[model samples]
Target chain A: MKVIETINLSKIFEGVVPVHAVNQVNLSIEDNEFTAIVGPSGSGKTTLLNMIGGLDRPTSGTIKVNQIALNELSENELINFRLKHIGFVFQSYNLIPVLSAKENAEFVMLLQNIPAKDRIARVEALLKEVGLEDKMNNRPSQLSGGQQQRVAVARALASKPDFVLADEPTANLDSKSAENLLDIMHRLNKEEGITFVFSTHDQRVIDRARRVITLEDGKIISDVIQHEN
Target chain B: MIFKVAWRNIWRHKVRSTVVFIAIALGLWAGLFTSAFTHGMMNQKIDSVIKMEMSHFQIHKPGFREELQVKLLMNDGENIVQAIQEEKEVIGVSGRIVTMAMLGSANKNGSVRLNGINPDDESIVTGINEKLVEGEYFRGVERNPILISRKIAEKYKVKIKSKVVLTMQDMEGNIVAGAFKVVGLFDTQNGMYDELNVFVRRDDMARLLGVGNSLHEIAVLLGRHDMAESMADKYQHVYPKLEVLPWMDLSTGMRMMIEMMDTYTFIIVGIILVALLFSIVNTMLMAVLERVKEIGMLMSIGMSKTRVFMMIVVETICLTFLGAPLGILLSYGSISYFGTHGINLGDAAYADMGFSNVIYPSLEYMDYLVVSMMVIIMAVLAAIYPAIKALRLKPVEAIRKI
Candidate 1:
């Protein structure tokens, strides 16, 4: 089941010399697929991921998530679509510093107007799965870098998005923390059939991904399937 | 959830937020207290003017006050006074033989407005008897007794039982002079009023000026200050030939002073609020700038612009309210304390300028509410610039920033 598809997607940042950040990229992401969009510096992995998640307006081309053309949506509609369908995990842990771990985890569900009881139940389960149940009441400042990332993960998944987008989620973590985060995500992808698309330079993330899509100078150079469940 | 985030966000920088809170509180306290002081001073001036100089309103035959024409006297002064005294609002009425004259002592000569009145009626109308510092209102000297202000006495080198000659034109336009002994010295605390006025017995003045029983001025004191204008209007209509004026109209400068002071009070409060507004704007802008990455994350996760804006506004308002209550309590406490105990501005300059030296700071309940409303409005306005700054954040770019 195709959850995301991009047809001839391109983005040009106009300047003294216009830079084509993402050019003529065609991609498809299916449900339960653990894919990594891999590239070096100045490559278009992050730009492509942003367009697919409805976070940026494409200069040209149409991005369809669940068959809804993202380019056709207004700014407000795009935000609503992202809230309902997509989750984001950033390179730096972006958990609200003022909120507790549980509060941060429940933030998305709260935005979705979910019932308090259901939200509490789901958030608790997600935090426990991320192994932060013990630290639920702790603020981000009180948590380790890896623990904060885990809270971010729980928070992204709280609204039960159709797919989660991870943009170098383990870039700032240590080797052990990175390995732990990848394993947790891999387990969720397999057991719950959750889809994830990561944009990363991290070899560890690429090694764990079931499919690797490589890009150079904003164009796809290679796509290789590692293993399928 | 947005409110929760906003509330917690304010306390994130405890020291900064506290500073902003204190700034707002102190600003409000200063503004309100200053307004109270102004109000107290003006109220005192108004009370003194109504009670001593101009008794709510006064009446005179048309053209009598402007020219001091002795012949243009109100021939039916006694009837007019009797009729006005019948009104329920009327507290006291006095028909006066008023004329501008020269009061000459042996050593010096001074210009004065001679108020010739029945001693009892004059005392009731202007409370002049209570202001006497020495001697009596109408007694001590048998043949001709006159009351002089301390300013007049000091200037003319006269005292109780000292004889003074008043010279003025009679109804026939002939210059007539009479010697009257100063029986009392009164101090009205109004320098200008005390300097220019002297009182003599109406019968003595009438005999000296040969005006028979005609009165040049009729002063009426009303129980309530607010009733002065309507009663003046009523009397003006009843006696169309007479020029009736309320205390506010007797001297247009007095009216202007009252209005100008009220305006100045609000302006002073407004200036303080505006200064505080800038401080709040700067503080909230810093708060927004500090959380660029976090705010971007919230937006990237689908928080609407309105919610983002409201979050900032609520945070700013929450911060302001922290100080607002403290400021209001401070203002209230100080106003109450100073109002009762009085703030004696140890300066005779105020008395010399026709105001009491001691001020009792006051504010109407409505004015307090108005000041609070102004503060709330200021807080909201202050939040706008910073909230807009937050709303302008683009998640794509802002996330890229550290």
Candidate 2:
């Protein structure tokens, strides 16, 4: 089953001169598939990711997630839909600065109105899986860059969304921290069958993706699949 | 959880939060203290006027007050006094023969309103005996002895036992003149009243004016001045022929002063809170602007716009809650202490204003509650603009904000 399908997705930024940020992009993301949307600067990868996560409305497009038409929903309805079915990770490691790692992980489920006992159990399990169990009580500022990203991943999965959309999730980390983050994400994908769609130019992320789509000037240039992990 | 996050968020910028907290606390303290001081001054003025000038209520023949003529004396003075004293609320009563006359000494002459009283009854009604600053109150003095204020003595260059002559029209239209000695000098701390009034024996004044056993005014003191209006109404109903007036009617200027004190206090405090409202809005706006990205992150994670708005409002309210109670406590302690010890505004300053030098600050319990509630309300009003500002940020754009 496809988790998200976008047909003829386009976004135009109107200014002194119009710029087509995302043009006629067609994509289907299947359940439990780890994919990467890779591109150079100005290629509209972030714009595409934002649309898929319901963070932005398309100039003209139809987005169906779990067979529900995204374009037909109001802005408020789109927020509710995103809350129930989609999770996002930004490159800046945007963990709430005042919240501990455990609380940050539990935040999405809290918004979901999950029972406190179940929320605590799931948060503990996810933090342990991401190798942040011991650092659960530390605020975002007290954690390392890699640890914060791992907490972000745990937060994204806490809502039990159909897929997680990450925009350059490893761009701000050191090489070793970037590698550790990728390993954690890969392990979670393999063990838990959680799907991920990331927008990145990082070679380390590209090397680890099972399928990669490359874009240039808002158009897909190549679509390739790797047989090796 | 939203409250917990908001509470922690305020402390993240300790200096900013502390600045707002201190501003609110100090603003409330200043407003309450100033209001209490104003209430104190008004209370002092009211008490002075009631005690030395107009006892709670006064009764008079209808035309006497308008004309100040000796002929307008009450026909049955003894019966009116007996009726007033029978009222359950009345604590003291006195009858007086009041007439406008000119007082002359060897060196100077001045116009005065002379009040003739039986010294013992007058003491119970106005406590005039206690205000005597020199010589004896009409006690142990010979016939035609009088009491004049120290202001009168200084102006006329007269002293105790100095002989002064009073000149007035008799009830039969004769211009009568009588010689009297100044037996006592009284200072009532009311410069205007002191300079205009002189107290003499009622018997002596009646004899000189040739109106035997007749009186112009009956003053009644009540157990509580707050009961004055009701008592005055009752007296007016019973003595329809006589004019019954409460202190508020007898002195319109002082009554207006008391009423204006309440209104002006509210207006002044309202202005202060409005100024505080702007300051609070500015601070909270800065907090919201600085946390744009974080706010975006929360909204993207499905914290509803309503929740986001409430978080900011709750944060502002929490800040006020932290500061207001402390301000109230501090103001209460200071007002209580000063109320007992009294704030002396110097003799000259008070004398010029026709009040006593010492003022005791006062506040009702409700004032503290009202002021604190006003601060909280101002904080809530202050939060609205900032909260709406937070809601206007689109997640995509806000997440991109540096």
Name the top lDDT candidate: 1
> Interface RMSDs of all predictions?
0.7, 0.8
- Per-residue alpha-carbon lDDT of model 1 for B1-402, expressed as tens digits? 888998998888899999999998999999999999999999999988888778889998877768888898888899999999999999999889989999999989978999999888888888999999988979867888999999889999998899999999998999999999999999887777888899999999999888888899888999999999999999899999889999998866789998899899879898999999999999999999989999988889988888889999999899999999999999999999999999998757888777887899998888889988988999899999999999898888888889
DockQ of each: 0.82, 0.75
DockQ of candidate 2? 0.75
Residue A211 of candidate 2: its Cα lDDT? 90
C-alpha lDDT score of every prediction, in listed order: 0.91, 0.89
Q: Candidate 1: how large is its RMSD? A: 1.5
Cα displacement (Å) at residue B84, model 2: 0.9
- Candidate 2 chain A has its poorest 10 consecutive residues by lDDT at A220-229
Range of the 10 consecutive residues with the lowest summed lDDT in candidate 2 chain B: B346-355
List the candidate 1 regions with Cα displacement exceeding 4 Å. Answer: none
Instruction: Give the top-scoring candidate (TM-score).
Output: 1
TM-score per model over all chains: 0.97, 0.96
Write model 1 residue lDDT over A147-202, tens digit each, in one string.
99999888888888999999999999999999999989999999999999999999
